[model samples]
Target chain A: MDSTPAQVPEGEDLERRAAELHDAMLVVDGLQYSHWNRGVLEELRAGGLAAVHVTIAYHELARETLSRIGEWNRRYQVHADLIRPVREISDIRRARDEGRVGIFYGFQNCSPIEDDIDLVEIFRQLGVFVMQLTYNNQSLLGTGCYEEVDSGITRFGRQVIAEMNRVGMLVDMSHSAERSTLEAIELSRRPIVISHANPASFHPARRNKSDAVLRALAESGGLLGFSAYPFHLRGGSDCTLADYCDMIARTADLMGIEHIGIGTDLCQQQPAEVLTWMRNGRWARELDYGEGSAEQPDWPTQPDWFRNAADFPQLTRGLLAHGFSEDDIARIMGGNWYRILEDGTQPRSA
Target chain B: MDSTPAQVPEGEDLERRAAELHDAMLVVDGLQYSHWNRGVLEELRAGGLAAVHVTIAYHELARETLSRIGEWNRRYQVHADLIRPVREISDIRRARDEGRVGIFYGFQNCSPIEDDIDLVEIFRQLGVFVMQLTYNNQSLLGTGCYEEVDSGITRFGRQVIAEMNRVGMLVDMSHSAERSTLEAIELSRRPIVISHANPASFHPARRNKSDAVLRALAESGGLLGFSAYPFHLRGGSDCTLADYCDMIARTADLMGIEHIGIGTDLCQQQPAEVLTWMRNGRWARELDYGEGSAEQPDWPTQPDWFRNAADFPQLTRGLLAHGFSEDDIARIMGGNWYRILEDGTQPRSA
Candidate 1:
């Protein structure tokens, strides 16, 4: 699908207003972890994002997640106009209020929580608002998506679910197993989220959830985040913003309105090692998948899903071209996730 | 009340053997959270202790805890027979085997566990075996002795209690409040301990447990360590080792040999700020006691009941003088606590 339309009468004015409004709006990325540095953040600011989740949980990523947080703080000082670390939903709003791209730090694995459930609140206080129960293999909490046989959530996992609810942290099951995902959905007191996943309409792999899970999530007031990973696209190489729109459109068609939003899974500055890390269970523990070549990066190359943050407008523009009302487009861009964050992460005491 | 012998049978061989056995037994202090440094550790070794619980949890003591751990490693290079950080029961055995002073790091509060229950396992792995739920004020887990109204263990605290059980951490409630202590005892699947506490036999302060709490702790298959801090000693300044012996004898009488032991809350080698910090909650907050002066190091001077580690044997001599049997003295000195550590802190997987 040609996502880019040729010679529109309102093109210049629409593009200018889109840039201006995007700059002004409180844009939050549901999930995206990249090997972010000054340049990558500048790209995000250029894309009109108010906040992005800086992920550091996979084993292949740098060992110290804390130091990564410190690194971001230090780097942002040199580029204060472009970026800042966001600890709360209000921080995101303040970033938008100040025209700075806010960063919400998160880990894709519950590993950083280690074994104690209480550390969840400490990390939350320290600005971590999102955590996946497992990273592609079994943890003390639950099984990951890549495990050969998923055992679902453990007894401790249920306790973690309850504690997370009490502490007001958003539970992301993007890389979790189907059994665990279903268990989490039932077990969580608050709405449980698949922070990034594709519908089987777009990809039938285990990495993608069925339309049923998406609908179930919506029923429970959770949001399904559409991943930007190329494998999730229906037409392998022939993919673009329009194809992504089609996937979102199909999800909207199947699950109805308010059930979907963009996860981007964008790796504008992510290194190849992060993909390799995700493929293995721990740093190097391979699941039953056949031995991969050491030379190859863990994940395949990005297929033409909008190149970087700079191409975010193309996504908004592409959705508009698909006959989606502007209100629906706004929800898809970020409003849906904003609602989930506000509702799901608000502390019970608060 | 004179702890020194009322009658000295001149030059008895049994008295000489008693002195020799006391000196030779590789006596371990089990616990002492003095603001430690090289000087303090050297004094511990000089005092002939095989090991001591180097506390890292009390707000004032830990600044040098990590450094002390490093120094112990360095001292192992020079005086390997004198010091080693103990992480497991096996380490205690190894320290005995190697004739090295085994340092089991302890926390006077779960503040280091911060809010994450996952940190329980992480710190357990790091050699922190004993953890107090609250110091003397409010923490995420529960209220301390100083909190005016004590709320029992929160739901998050329940999960933490379970995780601590699962991870083999000894839950200490020495400075914890009444309700929180009772709740912790009820919630922990494994035997929970008040690593150091006195009964109202000594002081009528919240710092000492009532007979009911002590009896319940003992009946639940847990031990209550009798603390020797003079503020809790009966008759205050007029008290002697015989008085201390009488208190331990009575506690032993009440709790049985298996459920009673001694934990000298020795503050030797700790500078004044350590006490001030303890009294004031680590310099971050002022004294919880309303009238305490903030600027001055307002903690009362170390009582004359005990001065240093060398004073341990006088208690044994005093206990024998008080007509307690040798077996009872052994249990009181360290054997009962040794059994408790073996029973309570072993990993479930083990």
Candidate 2:
């Protein structure tokens, strides 16, 4: 249930051009919170996702969060041919040379730090480069989108912001509240990010941010990796490539193209039951329907036009049809994210 | 410096009656997060605080929270004459009759729950009847006042709210953001409480609730325990008793007398350095001035009129001088908290 652009450049020529451009670009997905395995890793490697921010925590505690990191360490050992852990920006290039998907560790919540602020530095040492202060709920550092009121960053949050900045961890406010997101942008000495959320205007989900947040994000030198998760898309799984690209084009008008990238939020090869661990996270005795209703509570069907990592070419083709310059297409594809990753994760000198 | 109420109802006659009334009433302070020792418990007993919600965790992990509860159990055994643990709402009266301050366990943040939802019921069983979804910052359960954006109740937050509701663990949102607080009110089947915060109209701290939140809290049958924290007062430590009462009276007009009570956030006998644990916790590597400025970044001076638990009589005197009837004054002073605590902490039949 997808449509081509209103005027796609005449047939196979466009498809061939899109494939070449995608292959040539440094394609990066800022978030991948999947129940990933060898098969999923293989898909990413085959699809030319040169770099990815891999989620290792949802409602996990500091020790549990560390265990997830340990699990990834196991994955790196077993799937060395397909994936490599990217500890530094230069490592992505090294990974690409080796023809592996370069993955960086991230956390959806600040559970990894728990109450100890020193854990911020310890986590960075463990290779967790990007962390959202809150997932969908309120985190220790700040408010999430789902709390009743958007309490701004806590006093402790101010210290975390400075510590993260000093320690070289990029702050991601993808699931945070409006005031918290804006305050985070202003608070961080470094650029922060809304790694996987569309504009709220694009879809009325509270998970999506607002125009004001996007503009502030851009002004603060932050990134807004347009989400491809069905919940963030206008029509869910029925959303067309054209409609999704239209959203990106419109958002680019508000936030410059240079601030935009892709974050699919794709939970590939994941069971619907895995969603329980995600949405409920041992936090509920009863079942929780997060984005889906009780009648259809499961993983949403990814849009046919952009189903998985392999569908990157369709995105490139759609962008070209939207009249984006080849350079802008490259930037949106991965160039912008790469530049920011370099600046955002650079450790401050003593 | 303490100023007398603007104009008294004549002199010793009023003071004598207020003291007699205070002596007879069930004075409750909904929050007391302090570095308490046996001496502090003695102070509470001497002050005639019949019931008090004593904080056990700020940023402690689940096991650590249990240890604090264990420590309280020790206090109950050693200083049984001065303090008793209040597990049931009926236990408050027992404590009053016994001439001891009935102490209930509370957590400022949901750290005690960690990632386990089952901990809600376990904590309730352990006699933690009250828990704030968040402290001054974002928590796993919901948003805090200090975040930049108020993401609404999260998917996980929805579950936590429902579970807390089902388990009879009262949700306290004293430090939550506006939207999160409102959503928690709607989400919980039972009424939640903002256990310690002044109305935003009283002071402009991010820690204060707005009129909309206060109204919603009242309409939802929740309680508003007016905070005596200097930062929330009109003039910090210089706040006059009359000004504090005026804020309460104006709030009463809006919220009605039945919904309001006193939550003197009195960290009695806590040394200035303890503010570090209360404000910064271990989360910040750098010094964090939560409410205080860098120049005066320690414990704020409590207003002289209400310096400790010793000042409960002064609050009753102040309320009486504000033209409230004695019955209404009782509700504002402690009866509302009592009534709400009864309804809020009752576990449902299996």
Candidate 3:
């Protein structure tokens, strides 16, 4: 259920304007880990989303990645008012125009890439512009941010970055190790991204970035997608939209406007079954066979970010109230990322 | 070791220019989680950082957070050429002007608040402008992104948000949960922030925020900080600077200009001991008793983003290559954040 009308302090007029603007915007969320279901898609529509980057590489997803994509495709047809599977920039553009959300098929880890460079292109052709070389655990690429022994990016990671660049796929370093992130940034011919992580300025856990790292990313022309995980913020679980906007402003101050964008890594509609599996540690475990040892502890499971995706408008209203300009709001909402897709996803000229 | 310069591609000139610009830049990384040792502080100066947000609430920083602050103060005095502990916004400004890397006192978790509302003011008075309500685990305020069970903001969290507002401290939600983040946004009267984290456009892990989340943040007139962790990005560990910038640009396109800033969350100066503690789950354990199991199993352990803090120029060069405007670049490089700090840290009218 939506927040109570009594709880919604925004007047009906503000709500109306917010709804109008949200409806007109071409919104594209980079990552949505939620399980696909009618309720989830409905929430997407209710939130006025234009497109979403869906992940199909978690352990549970590993077995049925392709089948899930097909299922979503069928679902898209059934829910034409709400969703459209995105396969390219054109698909995203078309979806934005038609008021249908474009579904971009992306993998959270290479469990599906399964050590094949060719699969990288295959996935890219299927609309996986962004790909993380590793997941929570270390893999053929390198150690993840949560790992204890971080040796840096591995040889496989080098190959993956190269392949990703060759295929016009965007390489994400959100959960990667610090060494791997730095190495990837310096090694990739194309600009890479830390699509979803927090600044080390505020928090120093494995979950955030350092000022030096942000500078390195900015210098490399990579984008730092600011995240809104509550624990990472100063206010903990009690943070508000002003908190999220404050983060955006701080990131913009550090990375500059042209390089800033929004990547709210939401898990909408994914059922408890999947979330439960995530708690069990299969998702990160699959990334590294060695990490499955008895000594290695599983990820500390946690509740999913909002229960679902229907609450996007609240996010919009929050940003508007935080003092973001209409144009800047549009860019952060989707335009800056649209440019990235246009430039980064295109095949390189020989 | 740095990448082989002998393998210098045709873009060597660009690299040189980036390095020069980065060196000349009044670069101020928002936070550092390194142990307050000479080596780390030296590294900060080596990177030509104008200021660094030194942490006083990491794992090993237990009960001794005040000592750590005092240590930074002493170090700043001793390393006068290299560092100066900052206690106010103006102090940071002075550090930037003086060519000495400013040392801003910060806390990764509000455990330092130790269940006291007035401590918020005490810390703020001590130059703790940036504070994360929780670390990797939950606290009295709310849940951390890594907690197995995330309860939205507790009553204490609500009070924390309000107190932060009353005391003129910037609220950071980088490690928080969605419910808490949303709640903080709604509860706070001032512009709150998620200082660092990736855009949800790519990674769907708990650590990242959704596009809707970032949009909501921008809508609320707050800022979304882009981060540097790689796993949070699309292609886990293989991300590059271009991809990073793309994420930022995406947010900027959607959220508008003023709602963006850099909270780089740099942990460059952290000692190996601290890294070990952070990686060993001590940080989160310290925050929440009886909790602090390993991070989600799917999440990788600690992965370093870089060897140290000297590589900031690489990020700047990459951003310049990506076609970011100079004005926009300046904003991302820290101009916009200064404005936000001014707005967020203003003294509340009693």
Candidate 4:
């Protein structure tokens, strides 16, 4: 619960390298939806994070999503010393160079596009770099993982993927159904991402990807940002950093070292109501437990080793201990995500 | 194909009584979602329909549904001579006496309520008589017929049903999945209606009810409005009047005549886009060929015997020809619907 970074464990000699590696890396979390404030902003900087693909909307429509973007614009204005917008992929490098945490916009659901295909470009122009095909239910474009059937990419989904490719909006399928996710990988012209999910081989969860989907994603040149959210981990909140890093290593062996990275799925300092909004939206008149069970129907506790943004450095230390090479560690930390963004988030035709 | 009523096959005298029977009875069609205009209204009047539960929204949100209601309000003003809004159950009698087709507002989907439980009362106050829990896909309330699985009645669904019961909104489960529909029948304190569907025994379509559901519905004192929509018929557009009536007769034997009526899910004089809007709302970015397949995705042809609202007399003739007693024919025509609405659509507390 402490905001301050805990000191590196045991040997003072080993601490030097962990601190140096954390400082050297451009730590980019592929997804986080924390309740943004000046306090949360400070934590990302403390964690040595260069860029983060933060969720701007879950089930919001175009106009509502625009309002959320405006709110973030206000945050950028107020916290100029700590944060800047990643309008272009280069802005991330600029933030890393200047020591500000770069904020890149992403949608957890396709609601921001509504039914208008034109909004894909409009949002890309507005600096939204990543968009998932569906959140956790069937959407206009494709079926979400929570749905009964996995009807693959809809006709509109096919067109939207093309538009997202043209406009440089990276497709994210973190919460989409299996067939839809597989089809999205095959369908997208550019590399897609499962922005924040662990492998089902790591933890057989509804939200996790199959070995087949992960392999297809890697073959299609996609990135898989390993989720640190406990429910997707082997032992839920009790999952140790070693177990977490081990899952990443196994996933790397399957997906190739170049395709793996840490997303964490951190939702720092969010109220219970925000959790309700994300789970239920306007779709349910009743409570939808979502990833949580009825008895455990609130946000699950994040693992102690990875509680908030400030705990991100622990991931670097844990990965090093798990025997990944320095270059692989750098890529798994942020280098791979940065490489993907350089090509993926640029207007190809425009 | 003709607008004028054709002679009841091989019996001129039977045709005269069919007209008289249609005229003498209330002749309420439980559901109709035609693209309303002066022409469509004229057809309802020609059919001698005393009241019609007309769909005002398929997948419209609260504000959108309110706007739809506003559009209907405009129709009441423009077509006052031919039609009037049915605010109360007794409004049906008033319209019957006045020789105008009473238009009762209904929603084919629960989208109008959005996530708010209070909108159930708001819509009821606006003269919205019926609201289906789901259209053809999973919703916040319940699973639709098209979903691969059915997790019956969400927490919100239970609350919405109770709110509906308190506020006098008739719960209609015409397009919900089997478990959701069955759960709704058992859960609802008041009897629910399947406003537009046939027995699975007749057609065995996805949208049709099973004998188990139909029997439970009848046992619960509910009603089943036989849909004349061709996809729900045994022989599609070629189904004869005798075949249609025989299906009804078999259903009547199973369900009792008092629990049956006509819905004739008519979509008259509308462009193909309306069908797209109904089948695939904003939820589907692609064209969802609901009820119709990819090859035969457009609106299926209405049977020749029941092509339009003006063809209501043909149903009476067919039922009479099927040897239903005059009392049973009266019940099947409109009496049953009127009886149910008398108690089902009044706010119990109010």
Best by lDDT: 4
Tens digits of per-residue lDDT, candidate 4, B1-350, equal 12224544537777787778878898899998888989999999999999999998998886566557657765776788999988778888899899899999899999987887766765675678899999999999999999999999999999999978977888999999999999999999999999999999999999999999999999999999999999999989988888888989999999998899988889898888999899888878777898877898788888887889998888888887777887889899899999989889877742
TM-score of decoy 3: 0.45
DockQ for every prediction shown = 0.02, 0.01, 0.01, 0.01
Tens digit of lDDT per residue, candidate 3, span A220-288? 888876655544555544545555667777877888766766566666544545544543445444433
Task: For residue A26, give model 2's deviation from the true position in Å.
Answer: 73
Misplaced by over 4 Å in model 3 are A1-17, A60-64, A269-273, A279-307, B1-350
Q: Which scores greater on lDDT, model 1 or model 4?
A: 4
Q: What is the C-alpha RMSD of each candidate to the true structure, in Å?
A: 20.1, 23.0, 29.3, 20.1
Write candidate 3's Cα lDDT for B106-147 as tens digits: 677777777656567655755678777777677788887777
lDDT of 2 by residue, A41-120 (tens): 87787778889988888888765765576577557767889999897888888888889999998888887788877677
Question: What's the residue-level lDDT of B245 in candidate 2?
Answer: 88
Q: Considering only chain B, what TM-score does candidate 2 achieve?
A: 0.96
After best superposition, candidate 2 residue B114: deviation in angstroms?
0.7
Q: Clashing residue pairs, candidate 4?
A: A140-B285, A285-B156, A286-B156
